[model samples]
Target: MSAQSLRHQLLTADKPGRADLLFGYLRAHGNKHYEEEGTQMQHALQCAALATRGRESATLVAAALFHDIGHMLADDPVEANNPTLKDDLHEELGANYLKGIFPEAVLQPIQLHVAAKRYLCTLKPAYYEQLSEASQKSFRLQGGPMSEQEIAAFEQHPFHKAAVKLRGWDDQAKDVNVEHLEIDAFRASVLEALS
Candidate 1:
């Protein structure tokens, strides 16, 4: 992608107006995350800020903030007997999107969040147990229930630590107030630079 186009996607836009626009644009009934009990945009902000609280780097923080940005455009069903993250894995989508717009530092955390999820499910028994049913089910579909060997191998991956941290913050971020940051600020920052 060109520099300008890459520059554009990194921009965040999810507060009030952008949130509504995102909902209108991305939240169709068939869409899974739209009616998934929490606002998708709110979820993203919480995840991002949560990571920041852990003294995580800004890239990881940004990754947390926009971790599920792709899900805003995800294809999930709201009321299905079997909930699935079967659509495009938001991690890859969000990571690729980040790659186009941000540095590898940012893209790495996003790309690895799912792996982080899988890794956590393996090492932390209670941790995996704590996941929402939808989240737990996702681990299976997303290559969860990893074997001992798989877990051992995963530990060696470069981003494994960051991914794990991202996962923790991602889960702990389920707060109403944490979503308070203005996406417009991040959006304006990126847009202003490009403009």
Candidate 2:
């Protein structure tokens, strides 16, 4: 579907239709690579699977599945992997788009996942080295490690811990060999997250 139609669906569709549109959109355009070892669809499914396996809340599982959706929603989705491009602020874009559709339980983690990465890099120095080369490059574009003040504020967010967990899943979700459940597996979680 065209971006215009997708936006229209997101904006005007009923709850169930929104969920269907989301999964359909993912299935369609999610084959695009975004600096990960696997396709965007694979990464999303893997992260959601990790969240499901960990017994996280349904909202959180949905958040994990849709966290990087901002990449897909971008005017140029491939810009995420372009070292020369600036930070796309995809977290904010996604959270903003999803505002009316989902509750904060789902949006907060998506919004803070990037900050969670920055938080992790500071809280655990070794985490920086564990990042993929593309992630490392984006880390620089994403402002590297968080400052002391930033860390302090990040910790105060209600979803900080969830965001941190989502970040861990995000980091590990790039495995090309991992077989993940299909998007249909997350339908319930996605529907539950819908406002």
Model 2 misses residue 62 by how many Å? 0.7
Q: Where does candidate 1 stray beyond 4 Å?
A: 1-35, 75-87, 176-179, 184-195
Backbone clash tally (model 2) = 0
TM-score list, all predictions: 0.67, 0.90
Error of 1 at 61 (Å): 1.1
- Candidate with the greatest lDDT versus the true structure: 2
1-195: candidate 2 lDDT, tens digit per residue: 655556556779987899988898788778988876799999999999999999999999999999988887675554334343344688987777677888999999999999999899888879989998998899888998888899999999999999999999999999998877889999988988788
What clash pairs does model 2 have? none
The TM-score between candidate 2 and the true structure equals: 0.90
lDDT of 2 at 113: 94
Each model's Cα RMSD: 7.6, 4.0
